[model samples]
Target: MIRFEQVSKSYSGGVQALQKISFHIQPGEMAFLTGHSGAGKSTLLKLISIMERPSAGHVFINGHDLSKVNRKQIPFVRRDIGMIFQNHRLLRDNTIFDNVALPLVIEGYGLKAIRKRVETALDKVGLLDKARYYPNMLSGGEQQRVGIARAVVNTPPILLADEPTGNLDPKLSLEIMRLFEDFNSVGTSVLIATHDLGLIARMKYRTLTLTRGRMVQDGLEASGANGVES
Candidate 1:
């Protein structure tokens, strides 16, 4: 579970990216963050991942206050959260198996354990057959799936994706969303930041909308309107 209490973020130049944003994502829940560019969606995700610290207020993951977590403790905090990027950040020089196994390797897992977890993660994304292939050798969808596998290889309880389907076509986008839904069904809490309105419309999950650094709406599509005034 993640909770933000009157969180605000401002850069060195006094450029405010988020203004007193507050929301709570319950355990085993799935939600979407939708906003235009520079609307603070990515800033919110970075706060949860500890990539950026909030300038004011607090952010809690599971139960720990991230504002109190020091630099040395960030890595351990991140181990409980999985992150996916739009670009599918992977090592082109490495094989698919190596890319997905990087996290476990960094954690110093045994070879047998790494192999078992890597294969299982790849299998979940339907990319087990491409284990030996390099990232450049795979299609965009395949590469994204590999990224998803890498994100989940550690079996993190929470998943955060930023513009996960930004570069894919509609068909591929739906495929990627389905994978997230599958993960949520098994009890993982998911928070995705995206600008794809069509995709958001297709999914009935709760959505929070941001504008000019303020959270303007939060509701579900089933409640008549996709979002209610905040």
Candidate 2:
């Protein structure tokens, strides 16, 4: 779960990226966050991941107030969250298996444990067969799948994705969304920030709309899980 209480963020250059934002994402929920470029969508995700902090107001992630989060505890806070970028930030030097296994390796898990979890994560993304391939050897979709695998290898409670489907085709985008839904089905909170309106229209999850750094909407649509609202 994540909560933002009247949060606002401004860069050092005096650019205000978010303003008075407030919302709550419950556990086991998957939602789309839609907005144009510079609408504060990325800023919001960064706040949850603690990559950036708000200049005002408070941010609480899974019940810990980030305003009170100490330097020593930032890593622990991040341990409970996972994130995917549009660029599929995989290591070029590592194979798919190594990429997904990186987190567990950093956590100092045993080889047997790392293998079990990495394979499971790769399986969840339907990329287990490609585990031996390097990132450069894969297509955009495959690379993104590897990115998703890395994000979930630790079984984090929340997943933050920024424009995950931006580079994929319609069909592939749907496949990626389906994978995300499967993860949410088992209790991982997912918040995806995207500008692809066409794809978003097909994902009927509760969506929070933002414009000009303001949150404009957050609720369910009448048309079940594939509804769209402009």
Off by over 4 Å in 2: 221-230
lDDT per residue (tens digit) for residues 1-230 in model 1: 89999999999999999999999999999999988789899999999999999999999987789988999999988888889999999999999999999999989999999999999999999999999999999999899999999999999999999999999999999999999999999999999998887888899899888887888878775223333222
Give the 10-residue window scoring lowest on summed lDDT in candidate 1.
Answer: 221-230
User: What TM-score, computed on C-alpha atoms, does each candidate reach?
Assistant: 0.95, 0.94
Candidate 2, number of clashes: 1
Cα RMSD, each candidate: 2.4, 2.9
lDDT of 2: 0.87
Model 1: colliding residue pairs: none
For model 2, residues 1-230, the per-residue Cα lDDT tens digits are 89999999999998989999999999998998887788889999998878898999999877879989877878878878888999999999989999999888888999999999999999888889999999999999999999999999999999989999999999999999998998899999999998887776777788888777777778754223232334
Number of the top-ranking candidate, with TM-score as the measure: 1
